[model samples]
Target: MSEDIDSRRDDSGATAPAPRVAVEPTPQAPAGQAQPGPEAATPGAATQPPFNAGNPYAAQTQTVAHTVVKTKTKKLPVFLCSLAGMVVGAVLVVALIMTGALNVNRDAGTATATSEPSGGSQTIKIDAEDTTLAEAVSAKALPSVVSITAWSSGSSENVMQGDDSEASGSIGSGVVLDTDGNILTNNHVVEGATDITVSLNGESYEAELVGADTSSDLAVIKLKDVDAKNLTPIEVGDSDDLSVGEWVMAIGSPFGNEQSVSTGIVSSLYRSTALPTTSGTYIYANMIQTDAAINPGNSGGALVNDNGELVGINSIIESYSGSSSGVGFAIPSNYAVKIAKQIIGGKTPEHAYLGVRLGTVTASNARQNNLSVNEGAYVGEVIAGSPADEAGIKKGDVVTKVNDEQISSADSLIIALRSYDVGDTVTLTVQRGKNEKKIDVKLGSDADAQTSQGEETNTDSAEGAGNGMSEEEFLEYLRELMGNGGNNRQ
Candidate 1:
């Protein structure tokens, strides 16, 4: 068991029950045309897929073909970097586990909810054959789907990169957004390409970068010489309206097969993960989780809903083996569209920044720190000029909620902030001592996501720079930073 440390005193010299955040920094749908051909087959693998009608994420003894990883993975912070590497190396340890069964009792109804957590329900009821859903969605979506081949001059990642090395090509996917040929895909797809092309309906056209935001892992590119009148802009759906268990589809070039389609259901919502960049990290917030078989080449493909509307950009998958283990992630369409529009307007996308180092409040830390709650993000150190600092967030402040959304972890805080545009002010509910306080903060702006990671890439800014920092070492570093960080103000 973890050590007990919840008996700490508050600044007011009174006992409290604040929660401590535990840092486990770890890491789509689509629709389109005709009924997908019979399930994809792998040689020397199972002759039949364990995934049949109604089974979205369960398979026993089934193995996928292994391939070399070509995409860039984020560099991890010191403390859990090795742990994270181990986690990534071991993919799909935990399933999203939804419990809101929609009357689909398997053997008859298919998926059944095993149990529910104290809060929130799970899973959607499947109504039709997976093939029928895949076929209808594929037919409706394939027309707008485009195969992207990006040429870069740098070293290659299986997915994408903006390399200036010897010119080479990488394959990804995208969706047509308008008659203007403005297409939406992950930024990594066309990031550093000297030349990019988009193929639709078997005709290829040259494309140019409109704008790309690495922060959200999204980008917008425009096709050259394509008639806007002939474009079939895809229908954009509301991700906020999505629920667990809803059927979804993914269409892309997985392993370079164009228009390859897979069917699954929404696994969970508002998921968070950080990708290592040389500068620091790219944090993906409010993401959609599915088991739609997103593979390396599907980086910028479409995650569409049953209505054949775009819901997310199929992006990363959680697997230790570097292959699709049926646990995949997507950039929520709302954020994708929000950033895409900003890029289209010729401005870099901006995310709301709090400028504070945070720690997760767990039961032990809550008792140790005398906190009132057993879950929340504990404010360790606030940046001097940051919005949170200006708003009076101080060291030791436990933030329990952001604009009424209960913050259960540090990742939750990041997820809440990602939903807002920079310059938008919001309320923060903080548990200070014996009383709760609501502070309205005007969020500040940070540059759109960048291509590199930074010095503070570890679990929290409070831990200082470098890799492999233990908790005791992190506390010592935090003290040193506080001593030199100036600003003794509460």
Candidate 2:
């Protein structure tokens, strides 16, 4: 025997089976034993056990005697007990069937049962809840989306000469603006196009460019010879009230696939970016960022909320592969509509401009220059007779905040100014030497700045002043101002 086991006993412990007991009802109690009366057998009586007094499965009450007898019988096997239980269940099921107690309805292999509530029974229509959020929104918005085809000059000659490869045409998307045949789209989409065609609801209509704002990358076009009843303008939502993580849908012609729909949530808000265009570096500010699949032809399409209201215009996508990488940006509807309204009224679109040459501050540079703050935009020069100069903002002043928003760099300050309209007054928090002060300055117009100073105004236009700088030169200038070394955001 091993030490781990108890080996005190000389032999293995084996015993015979215990005696069995049989219970039998007695006609009378034994001598000197008390007898149970009829009241003792009654349900809920004080003398009865509470659990068994009213139990339906309880056996009848009786005075019983137990007798022990020695036997050589073995315990029943599990198989025998299981078989007996199955037999009892089958018998009970048959009894229920005979008494009409259980009924199961099966139709087309689907089993359904009617249930009654405490008040009454009712009928339910499961199909009534089948409509989904995406389905409903798409139904309401698809009519407002239109596919655009732009034809550049000399395309008619190319077609007449049987030279399809030389035809100058581009595909894009647009949103219907009104019943009078006005459509909203990106300026880059229809830029320099001699002929513009709009395809809506299986019909094509000729369109003419109404106005184009290169700074904001927005344009308006009007359809010719189109019926007013055929147009459906989309409902616009308040982009200022939009919150991050809210559901949004992108309706556009991705890859020229008309009426393509994609869904995503708002990834961020109030984002700023710049894109290199033929005219200049187009500045996008206070943009709504989403993860929706915005592709090449999705520009100027609708970015709508779950309520089927247009919140943004799908404009730009940040991806290295030139395809959607789950990062896209849109122009807020409030600002886009403002520009559209200006264009419709035959007025040029205006952007807020600050007359200052700015540079970003760094820790080492701040220490070298003995500046009080290590972050914020460093004012290199303030234009004379400009808003900053009028407000006593001098050179060497670091702008720390614009209104309530913190300005961490030169690019941020420019982006912040782009959100406001011209002539709007804003409070700027400046760090001059060791003292901080607030100054109120009214913004000026970019259009006025360009016309008044011609090519001499080096003031900040937010997009590098449209001074005919090549793409490489503009990017290099942005690098120095933003302090991002050489990695241009565009």
Candidate 3:
């Protein structure tokens, strides 16, 4: 009833709901009006405008329109694609199952697939026989291998030093060389032994030293009053036949353990090292190197090849631990035989006394020194009253040959001289000025031979000439790696 009545609606006179209007498509267009085509009513096409109720005639001109969408054409392409994809998936699934689960390559006799390791190399197992060549060699050589016990009044300091007390003894191994109970072992093994006991095949016999050479580190001892009916010496093998990779076995008493055997390959050949034996310092040349575990007690033991032949004598080891560091040196059987033979013949082996300062005669030296031959030991100085001087050998006289052996270097002369006894006469082919002459000179004793070195010896030695050791305890040991017979190797 107030001033706000004019802005309000009248509810008493409210009209009924307007009738809903419906629109329809026109059947035809007037001459001047344009008409829609069939595409105008298609899905997602132009839509209709709002219906008009004020003009009934306008409503009558509208007609309802309907359009049908064809879905079969689109669905036909999808069905074909699905069928092709299912066939390809089945083929891939079958191939994967064959390789992963079936292990199909085994049935096809296929080669194994190889793959490189991530970081390091891959190894394959190789089949090898259970038996070794060392077994046969040891069996054949063990019978000839003997255990030696040395008793001395001096302090008990020797290789293979036994359980015997300081005032008692030492122990080592030796090889039997002959049927007469002669054994061959290192000179140091019985070096200072006042008494020696040789045990062979469980029978022990008293031994006497026959001959010992300190220079060569070798000695021969004899088993006194023992039965030699079944005794067989070791078989000697050629050391020259030893190749660097050939198999070798060591038969000896290591740490007083008798009949202990170790096997290895020849690591090297022709090694020269100065060793301290029972006698003195000796230069061992043309030696065999092996890793066959040569220990302190193994000294004077046998170093045999695969055929059980004695190729070397285990003497010294080059080590800092005072044990086998797998680097052991052995005396070549050839040199050992040569030394043993001289000592066994009741003659002391001495270096031949060629009293002259010698030099190697090269082609240059031959031309410069007016030498007749290009190779030989050249005489630089002739000591007065020596074998060379007494034999009319003068300075500048080149020694072309000694006896039947050629003298190429100074060492060859010494080696050739060592092969013979001191009193043995050797023929020397000498070149004086321009003429070649032969002179026979008797080799002198050790005392006289000391001055025979290439350089002038300052002092005269007064020692007597002998095989360095007494033959009373001299026994030779030799074994055949083949049949076990003669014991002498040198």
Candidate 4:
């Protein structure tokens, strides 16, 4: 074999190829026979000994990775469920806010705010003149106004016996005219009174009667045990300056409530009504008419002008019964102040009287009678020996004016005459048969007229048949006859 290999490598030191030797074939083992060799004994061979049989690290590592992957994959659904729960919770919260289910109370808070609002804008601004006038009047007048209560016996007789009669209390208003506690009120308030009390700012005090004038329905009372400190006197205003539809304010006790205030305009001026008094005498006079709410307790209250000055005293309400009928009457402050001064001075003031039964000359009556003076007071009758009779005033004359003041109607004449007193000379202008004549006549007292009528009963009765006396005149004649101590009438 070596020689042959050397011959093959002859030209370039090449070794000869090995000779093909005829080798015997190896014994063919069965397909399942175990092989015996170093090849068979390798680690991965089936016949090899197991070197790492006790340890299964490789397989265990693969098993552990697969388990970790499966466990991670299983957690996705849990995470998704948790996220859906959070979304549901957020949606519920949003729905709750969308619906209104809250409660709030406002009136409970307002009840606690007791102080009035002072900083708001005013609806109307008071002018300097108006403010000055109000300040000047209100500063003094508020303290002068007082509330009065008079308790009277209900029994017509035995009123002085306080124990036998039922007590009925009346509420009214008053004005303090001076610093000496002299207060002015209506006569009707103190009439038949067993007890009288005055109140100011919620304080009560006893009042003593100064005097009373039944004809004018006025009375004066003095407060006891009180000094007039800080008392404001009401400013006196001229009623003559008052015009119809002027703004006015009424301050008084209305419906037994004190310090009640009402405002209205003067509806009419120079009004007249015959109010019946407790003494069975008629108070025939002039008054101012207003639409202000004047209840039963508002009598004697002050009717103030827009300047807050005293213009009139609330006297009566034109009602069917004892309630207000939207027509309130007030006595002019001119007359009230005059009567108050007289009462304070201890002088009994007498009312001026013109002894004549007068009626308004209506348009129809003026046209039918062809009267010389139209729209004037038609003198129906004149008392004998009276002012008109003494001044040569005839029964057929019509009064057109008194003392240069034109009498638009009978009411105007009456209002004008109220300003004068007894013994005052008044010039009367009368028209008779197209002749206007002025007659100067002295006024007499109302008492004088009553005395004169009392003395003329039989003469009036004898002339009643020839005078075309109506039923009302015949009744008046009979009343006068009875009052004059005539034996036939009673």
RMSD of 3: 36.3
Please list the Cα RMSD from the true structure of every candidate, rounded to 1 decimal place. Answer: 24.1, 25.4, 36.3, 45.2
Query: Across residues 1-490, which tens digit of lDDT does each residue of candidate 3 receive?
Result: 0000010000112122233558987667778754677655554454556667788567444345678887656788798999999999989879887779644333212111111111111122222244345655665678777888777775334424654445555567887776777778887678777888877878878889998876667888989997766466777778989999999999887767778899999999876533222233354666899989887677788999877778898877744335576887788887786667777777765554556655556677578866678876666676677776788887777777887778765434544566666578889898877798999988776644432321443323211121121111111100111112211112
For each candidate, give its TM-score against the true structure.
0.58, 0.65, 0.51, 0.54
Kindly list the per-residue Cα lDDT of model 1 for residues 1-490, writing each as its tens digit: 0001011100001122333548875432245533445784543564645455576565645556667879766655654788987887555433222333332332312222111111111233444544465666676677767888887664334334554356666678897877778888876677677788788877889899988776566889999998755566777788899999999998887767787889999999977754433322345777898988877678788899987778998877654334476778888888788788888887757778777777777787778878888888778777777788889888878889988788876655765787787789899999888779999998876652221223335443322110112344334333432242211101
| CA lDDT of every candidate | 0.67, 0.73, 0.64, 0.63
Q: Between candidates 1 and 2, which one is better according to TM-score?
A: 2
In order of listing, the candidates' clash counts read 68, 0, 38, 4
Which tens-of-lDDT digit does each residue in 1-490 have in candidate 2? 0001011100112122233547887677689865677655554434433456567797757444556998775567767988999999999988988888854432222212121111111122222146567876787777888998887765755665887675676677898877777888888788788888788999989999999887778999999998876877777778998999999999988778898899999999988865554455567898899998888788889999987788998887754345576888899999988889888888867788778877777687889999999888888778777778889898999999999999877766777788887789999999999999999998887676555644554533333431122344345445554343222243
In candidate 1, which residue ranges exceed 4 Å CA deviation?
A: 1-133, 154-165, 357-386, 395-400, 403-411, 421-425, 429-438, 447-490
- CA lDDT of 286 in candidate 4? 58
Q: Which model scores highest in TM-score?
A: 2
Residue 237, candidate 3: alpha-carbon lDDT = 78
Tell me, by lDDT, which candidate is best: 2
Give the Cα error of residue 288 in candidate 4, in Å: 2.9
Q: Which stretches of candidate 4 lie over 4 Å from their true place?
A: 1-140, 154-165, 280-286, 320-322, 355-386, 394-416, 419-438, 445-490
Better of 2 and 3 by lDDT: 2
Sort by TM-score, top down from the best = 2, 1, 4, 3
Better of 2 and 3 by TM-score: 2
